[model samples]
Target chain A: MTQEKPTVVLLTADGVPEPADLAEVRDLTDVRVCTAGTLADTLPGAEILLVWDIFSGALSDAWHAADSLRWIHVAAAGVDALLFDELRESDVLVTNARGVFDGPIAEYVLACVLAHDKRLHETEAFQRAGQWRHRETIRVAGRRALVVGTGGIGRATARLLRAVGMDVRGAGRRERDDDEDFGHVVDSADLAAHLREVDHLVMVAPLTEATRGMLGAPELAALPDGAHVINVGRGELVDQDALTAELATGRLSAHLDVVVVEPLPVGDPLWTLEGAHISPHMSGDVEGWRDTLSAQFLTHLRTWLGGDEPAPAVDKGRGYVSG
Target chain B: MTQEKPTVVLLTADGVPEPADLAEVRDLTDVRVCTAGTLADTLPGAEILLVWDIFSGALSDAWHAADSLRWIHVAAAGVDALLFDELRESDVLVTNARGVFDGPIAEYVLACVLAHDKRLHETEAFQRAGQWRHRETIRVAGRRALVVGTGGIGRATARLLRAVGMDVRGAGRRERDDDEDFGHVVDSADLAAHLREVDHLVMVAPLTEATRGMLGAPELAALPDGAHVINVGRGELVDQDALTAELATGRLSAHLDVVVVEPLPVGDPLWTLEGAHISPHMSGDVEGWRDTLSAQFLTHLRTWLGGDEPAPAVDKGRGYVSG
Candidate 1:
């Protein structure tokens, strides 16, 4: 007899499964994949709780109360939302979509770097105005770049930048971790010091005790004039007020993929910074992205179910820190 | 017995050299670096003609007419300015600041690809306008890109894009006499055919008779609709009217570093293409760029005086083709 298909509960809020995904769900009669937009209902008989965007805010008490919540697979790459006090204390196992975004996000970082270095926006404006101004730009090659959070995103960015002849240095909690050594990996404490010497700084770290408000007035001020900043990590990790103020003075420039108050309120000064390149938190939204995410989730699920140590298990001590 | 330092003719309309540049130009004695700006005054007794802004249309005549001009070095990469009927017949050995721009221009192409793929502009607009509209974009990874022109710029762009997980195909004229064969290099003829299959098409070609008007209406229409177009090559190579029309419809998008009529002109409709990115021809401009160019020129000058074939020569057939 064929073994019974395992049960799975997909809590992807506002996500409508495509026909192909539905077919995967219906393949196993024993597998009942149910979605919950809000965390109101407990996952009944769910061996796997796929917390897509369903776990964005504080989770419902009933979610933790459910004994069936043995495993939580976050659809998003960053899992700080699920790493709340209650969830962190649980004995439940958690895995994230680490490899899914490494390349796309890294591409985003490079794109921002190119856009800033090349004065793309100004060029576009000049083109529209029918003006041919022979402007100048700096070459990214051979420049120093500091990537905070030397995880998948940092690793990918470092590799891409290094391939272009950039002197890439990656910063994390510590550099001696034999478990990971990417680019010219350095320690987080030394990141500010590194910024002084580097030309570009890309933040891909999580918003946690060690990193929240890490790039505040002092840090933003630390960057050399004309130094550029791109943040693909959490917005709260940077002090927006300080960033905008610094940019206003033309000391530092920035490209923000995430904002402290996304859809930044109208009339916000950030909209006016000539050097600022803003995107709506979309560094990882690539076409067919859902499929990539699902495939990654399926692969990880198989490994976890086989009792193999999960490829990207949660490091509760470090949270989710990568690009 | 020291050979008199070469008298350099700074062939630019505006003869201003930065202090730092003057310091480096010390190798030339009496440093008679005259500016041959006016059409009639092609520096007399000038052994070396440093052609800056050689793209200014009239330099071809000046270059060919300089009776004493022995070595002609162009500030810009494309020697099309030096390739007219007159100069082609002259024996003046032509050199260019070729390698100075290879990495910088390549970085510009990569930047355009990134900006388009990430939708940085739209996102920034939405963010500044306080509008939250989520959209998915194409991932450069796992996609095929055809980088035309397998010279220095082409090679640099391909390497960086490849590092981003892009399947890159490089194409150039594989001549029998040429020793450099970039692996996976295709012949130029294959480019027109390759358009239909590529996701991104980056043009770094020079403005030769074979290349001018190469990416015109028919070629632009032949490309798969969504393919992102980047041209750091000669503006004439791409039919400007065709590109503007295609970009207007948003069926195709482009980042143009060089355009046919730059300083586009006041009120030119070309400035209004929703998908077209036009800058004031600044891709090759970088902080302290002149220094790099001068440094490169000096290296090649040393090599030439030492009785060695310069590391690369200007391809008389291709005009400004590099090492």
Candidate 2:
């Protein structure tokens, strides 16, 4: 007696996923594609939900319609926005795209650090005005970096920074002395104390209740003058108001890929803030990323269909894939 | 018998070096600092010359006044502009600030490559316009880079690029299968044939008759479309006209720290070229770099005063310090 195929819902941010992207898994499941507005209507009988829209919060709004949902896969490294109390209380399994973003985001963090030290933006401004002004740049090899996450993404960042000769440390739930990537893993509870010595404060922590607004007013003030803040994780991981206020004083510079409110509200001061490098939440979405992400989901889907659990199942209670 | 201290002419581009910067060597020598207009007047009776102004070509014009010159030390890695046929034939020994620039310039090269791959300049433009456009960036890791010139700076660049996971190759006077920093070293004589496969073509070759204009029309035409050209080396190493023509077509992008004309003549086409990133040759001139450069010169000066040869002397005939 064979079991009936599960109905799969592909929730997207805009439009629908390309047929070519889902080709390999098309015949194995009953697929239903929908945007946020249609998600509730399409979720009734679906047992599997593929969150293709990384930034969507529609899952929680349409949770009542998820009558038969047994599993959900986020095509992104962070599930901060999608996590709701009800979903965490449910028996449904959750998994995420973790390994795919590690290297790309690590490279982006390094890029932000190098861009600040080398004054590339100022150089670009000079280029625009046809100016030939020469200025001394800062050396990056010996600078200190504090990566505020100890997960896969943060570990990747620490290793890359160390490889480039930076003095790197990690901040996680607890402290460790002999971590391979970060020589000293500082406890997140003591993050403020460590900021005074950090040259680059990189934020890659998932946005959980315990981690929300981790770098607040006190942490911002703790960083050394002229320290660079790079956030490739969720924007809520930092206190945006405090960050903008500090940036206004020119005491620190920031490279924000994710902001508390993305699309960042056109009227936001950070859009024109001096020393604030703003990019639209795309640190890890490199070319052909969607294809890679879909392929990863397909592999996990295959495992689930074959009566095996996915290797990297997300810890729903913690809101991330815990080691 | 006690010997008289040597008279030293410090050729400067604009103002004199700070007295504090020269305090260590001041009591050991007769120091005469002068700009280009005053170089010839200061050259007479000076047994040693220190080229403090990296971009000055005053030495060639004042060579006839070097009545007793025994040694010349350049406060930079390149000796291209300072090298003249008469000086090469003279009995004077030439030494350069080699090791000091290797690491800094290598960091700058990595910065440029990352800047290009990550679309940093474009991101800055979007921020200025209050635009939050999401675009997919290219990955730097696994990308191929061909570093021209196998000198100290080029070798350091190869190592750093490799450290960041790039597939790096070296272009030098000859080809070799095995190299520590670069797995394969390609003969620069066949540069064009190697261009198609390179994602980034970095020119760090010291300027010499053999290498001058090496990346001319044929070489530029051979590179894969969308390839980035970065020149931290002397501008003459590339044919600026050919480079400009290619840049105008938008088939390639460039980060030029050096151009054929210093200050790049106000109305040069490259100043407004869309894909061109022009910086006033400051790649290796990081903060505190001047102090470091001067300190290095003093150490070499002390070695010479003690009757031992200054180590890492430049091969005046080759226009660089050959291994």
Best by lDDT: 2
By summed lDDT, the worst window of 10 consecutive residues in model 1 chain A runs over A29-38
Question: TM-score winner among the candidates?
Answer: 2
Model 1: what TM-score for its first chain?
Answer: 0.88
Residue B147, model 2: lDDT of 99
Note the Cα lDDT for every prediction shown: 0.72, 0.91
Lowest lDDT 10-residue stretch of candidate 2 chain B: B14-23
Q: Where is the poorest 10-residue window by lDDT in model 2 chain A?
A: A14-23
Candidate 2 C-alpha lDDT tens digits along A47-157: 999988887899889999999999999988999878999999999999999899999999999999999999999888888887889999999999999999999999999
**Native contacts, share recovered per candidate:** 0.79, 0.90
- Show model 2 residue runs off by greater than 4 Å: A19-21, B19-21
Give lDDT tens digits, candidate 1, residues A167-271.
878788867534333545777875566678878899998778888888888878788888999999888889899999988888888888788887766787777
Docking quality of model 1: it rates as medium
State the lDDT at A28 in candidate 2.
88
lDDT by residue for model 1 (B1-323), tens: 86766566665566446434555566543344334456436455666766665555565546535667677777777887666766666676778777777777777777887777778767766655666677887777777888888777787778777766778887777623322333466677645665888778888888788788888887788889788888888788888888888888888888777778765666656677678777766677688887777777767667766766555668676576544
Clashes of each: 15, 0
What TM-score fits each model? 0.88, 0.97
